[model samples]
Target: MNIVFPTLRNGLFGAILALSPMLAAQAKTPADQLIVGMSMVNLFSIDPANAPGLDASGINANLYDTLVKRDNGNPERHVPQLAESWTVSEDGKQITFKLRSDVKFHSGNPLTAEDVAWSLYRVMKLNFGLATTWKAYGYNLDNIQASIRATDAHTLVIDLPQPTDPLLVIDSLAISPSAVVVDRKQALQHEKNGDLGAAWLVTNEAGSGPFTLSKWSANDSLVMTRFDGYWAGPAKMKRVLVRHMTESQSLRLMLERGDLDLAYGMAAPDIKAIERSDALQVQALQRGTMYYVAMSMKQPEFAKQQVREAVRNLIDYQGIDQQVMPHYGTLNQQPMQLGLAARLPDPGYTMDVAKAKALLAEAGYPNGFNTTIRILSEPPFIDIAARMQATLAEGGIKATIVTGTGNQVYGAMRARNFEMIVARGAERYPHPYFSLRTFVYNPDNSDAAGLPNFQGWRASFFNQQLNELIDRAGVERDADQRLKLYHQAQTLYDKQVGPIMMISQMTDTAVSAADVKGFTGDDAEATRYLGVYKQR
Candidate 1:
C-alpha cells in the first residue's frame, strides 16, 4: 500500500498565524480548546481494525469502543460498557459477560448479546491480526465463533476452544456495540468496503458509550460530543474536537499560542520544548509501548544468525536514548518483555566496541554490512534511527535511514521489503503473549494467525518452543509455571530472533491539562472508553 502525508509546514501549520491576538479573539481557558496537528507521516486510518500504525490507535481511542474496557484513568481496573460484569468458567473455556441494562448505540439502538457475539466472532474470523488485542484473542480462542452464544438480551456467553488465560487478550480488545452488528453476514459485506463494522460505526456514532461521534472530517479533524443518556451521566467536558496536526513544531506552536488544550503522540525532542515553556504543561502515561529496529529474516546479514547477533551486540540504547529521543528508556528491555509480562527478560548488551568488532569478524563481515532502515517521517523517530545508524557503523554495520509515513513503511515492512525499519511500538497491555504473537513469531500459514512477523525469524528451536509455551501459558495458570514457560519463550526470542534493537529513543505523549479528564492511565491502547468524559 502506498502512503503519503500532507506537509504540516503549510500556512495552516503556522501555529500563531491563525491564532494571533489580532485574529478572532475569544475568552476561553487553554482547557476549553483542544487542537492537535499530527505530522501526516504518522497518520493512519481512525478505524481500529484497519488502523495503519500506532497513531491510528491513538485516534481510534476517541472514535471507537472496545468490549470489557480497560480503565484509562487507572490502567489496572476495568469498567463495563456493553457488558456490565463477567464470569470465567472453571475450565477457563467459557466466559459469560453480564451486559449493562441501560446501554444504547450512539445512534440510539439498544445493545444486545447477539451484537456482542457477532462483533467478537467477525473480528476473529476475518483473521488479520486485525486488531492487536483481537489477534491474541484469536489465538486464545481455539474457535470463539462457534462458542459465542447469547444466553439472554443482557448476557454474552463465549466458549473458548481452549483454556487460555484472559489477562492479556481480554484487556486489549475493546468491545463494540452489539446493536450495531445486527448479524454476522452484514459485517462481512461491509468489510469489503474498508469499513469493519467498527469503521462504519465511525461516519455515524452507534456505540453505547459516552461520546457520540459528531464529525470525522478526514485529513483535518474529528469531533465528538458527550452522550446524554450515557450510563456515567455526563463527561466533565462539553465537546471534544480532535484536529490533525502532524508537525511537532506546529503542535508546540498551537499549545503556546493557546489554540490547543491538549496534544498527544508528541515527538521525543519536542517534550523538552514544551516542558521549558510556562504557557504549556505536560502529563505522561509512561507508555506500555516501545520502538525497535527490525529486519526481514531474509536479509543477507540477518540470513546469517551470527551476523544478526553481531548487530544486536552493537545497539547502544542508553547512549542513543540520552542523545537522540531523550525520553525515559530502559536499555535492557525489548518491547515484548513489557505489557503483561512485567517481569520478563531485560536483554542488556553493553556497548563494547571491541566485542562488537569481534562479533563482526566472526560473522565474516570484518569490513561491515550495509543496510537501509525505513521509518515514519517523525523527527524524534528519525533521530533514533540516525543514532542507530551511527552506532551500527562503529561496529561494522553501515546503516541508512529511509523515512515515510507509517502506512508506507509498515506495508513494506510486512512484505519484507526493507532491510530494516525503526519500529516504534507499545502494546495495549504488559504481556509477553502480545509480543510473541505479533512481532516475535512468524506465522507461515496464509491465515496470518499471529501478526506480520516482519523480522522473518524461523529458528525451529525458537519457533517450536514459542508455539508450545503459548499453549503452556494457557493450561498452567500457576503464576510460577506460566513465568517459566514465558522465560523459555523469551530466551529463544531475544537470542535467536533477528531484529536486534532498542526501546530507549521513541515518541512520548501527553494530554493538554485542560482538554479532558477521567482517562484510565495504564491500560494499554488506552481502553475503557465508557469512562471517558468531555469535560464541561
Candidate 2:
C-alpha cells in the first residue's frame, strides 16, 4: 500500500527530487506516532476470551491490563500490574490479590476486583478456545464463580479447584490472553444473550490500558489512541497505527523508506539485506511456540511405534535448521522451549534412511506407504514441508504436500482429520510443566472428547504414564521433584515415539527504524507499547 505524508522542508525535497523514484517516495513518520506493518490475516478478533492468535495477543496487550505481567528478563517471575500485591495461603489452594484503587477503564469506570473476577468468569462462561487454559486447570463454568470472586472492591480471591501449583496459575494470569481484566459494568451494558459483550468486544475494548482502541477493521487497519487518563501514564507515542500488510517485499520497501516504523513477519532474505543498513534495526525475538510435524495416531500406519520411529528418523533436522529455519526459528528437538532449566539436551535424532527403512519393514511397510502432509501456504512451514517430503521419500515414504490457509491447515489437525501436519503451536510461554502438558499430556484420547486444545489429543497420542508425570509435575511443591517429573515425562515420550516430533522453536523477527526504542517483545507474544517511543 502507498503511504503519503506531508511534504518535508522545501529544500530537503528539492535536494532528493532528481534521485530515483524510490528515493523520491521516502516518507518520514510523525514524531508522536508509530506506523507498523504486519500480516493481519489471523487477527480477526481482539476479544481476549476467544482470540488465540499471536497477532491478536500483541494488539490486546496494548488495549488491556492483566492482574500481573511476566518479567521480560525472567519468564518465571511476575511483576504486578492491576494487582499491586498478592499472597498465597499455606495450603496452596488460595490466592488473594490486592488491586490498585486508582485505576479506571477507558469508559471512566473504576477498575475494581469485581471487574477482574468478571473477566475470568466471562472466559469460562464463553467456553471459547482460550477457555481451555482455565479448563486444563480444573476450573469449570459451574464452579468458577465461587472459586474466583471479589472479596471487596479492591480485593480478589481465587480458590484452586484442584492441587495444581499456585505459581502456574499466577503465570497463567501473567500470560494468558483471557486473563486481561475488562470493564464489567460497561461490558454488561452491551451484553446480549448472556455473552458478556463478547460480540462488542470483538472489535471494541473496554480496558484501562495505556492505549485505547480508536478504530479497527478486519483485514485492513487498526488505530490505537493514547488514553490521557491512563493509570500507568500515557504511552510515549500518541497514536499507534497498524496497517494490514501480507507482502514481505512491501514491508521491506516501506521500512527502508522510513514510512513504516516497524514490521513483523518479514522474510529472512529481506531482513539479511537490511541488516547492515544504519537507518534500520532488526531484533530476533524468541517466542515460546514450537514448530513440529505431527502424525495422527488414528491412522493405522502412524499407530505403530515402529512406524513413528521411522518417520522421526526420516526427518532432516540438521539440514532443515541450516537451510530453511534461519530467522524463523532455532534448532529445538525437545517439546519444551530452549533456555528453560528443566529442558534436557536434544536427543540428536538425524536422518538415518537405513534405520527408517528397517523400521518401516518391521512395521509391515516394506515399501513406504503413501501419505498426505498438511501445511500452511506460508514461509518456513511450506519450506520445511518440502524438505520433509524429500527426506521422507528417501526412506521410501511417498508423501503428497497439501497447502492451505492457517485455518484450513490447523483446523484439520484440531479436528483429528489430518494424517500429518507441519505447524507451530499451543504453549506461548516458557515453562516446563505447561510445555509438557501442551505437547505430551492427553487426559482423554477419544474423538468424542473434542479436546482440540491439547495437541496430544489432536494427534490421538495418549500414554497414561506421560499424563500422570505431567500432572504430578504441575502440582509438585518441591522444585527438584517437579524437575524430576518433567524429565521422566520427556523420557517416556521419547520411548513411546510420540506422534508430534518437535523440529524448532519459533523466533519472530521484528524489523524497525533505528529510532523506534523500547520495543521489547514478550515471549508470550503479549508485547506492550507503553514504553516504546521514537528517539526522534
Q: Give the number of the best model, judged by TM-score.
A: 2
Among all candidates shown, the one with the greatest lDDT: 2
Q: What's the residue-level lDDT of 376 in candidate 1? A: 68
Q: Write the per-residue lDDT of candidate 2 for residues 261-310, one digit (tens) a residue.
A: 99998888988999999999999999999999999999999999999999
lDDT of 1 by residue, 251-301 (tens): 665666556666765666677766766555576665545667666555667
Candidate 1's C-alpha runs over 4 A off are 1-33, 37-40, 71-77, 131-143, 166-169, 172-206, 267-270, 273-279, 328-332, 335-345, 443-450, 453-462, 505-507, 511-522, 527-536
Query: Which consecutive 10 residues in model 1 have the weakest lDDT in total?
Result: 175-184
TM-score of 1: 0.82
lDDT of 2: 0.87
Q: Which runs in model 2 stand beyond 4 Å of their true positions?
A: 1-26
Given candidate 2, what's the lDDT at residue 478?
88
lDDT of 1 at 322: 68
* Candidate 2, residue 142: lDDT: 93
Clashing pairs in 2: none
The estimated TM-scores of all candidates read: 0.82, 0.92
The CA lDDT at 140 in model 2 is 93
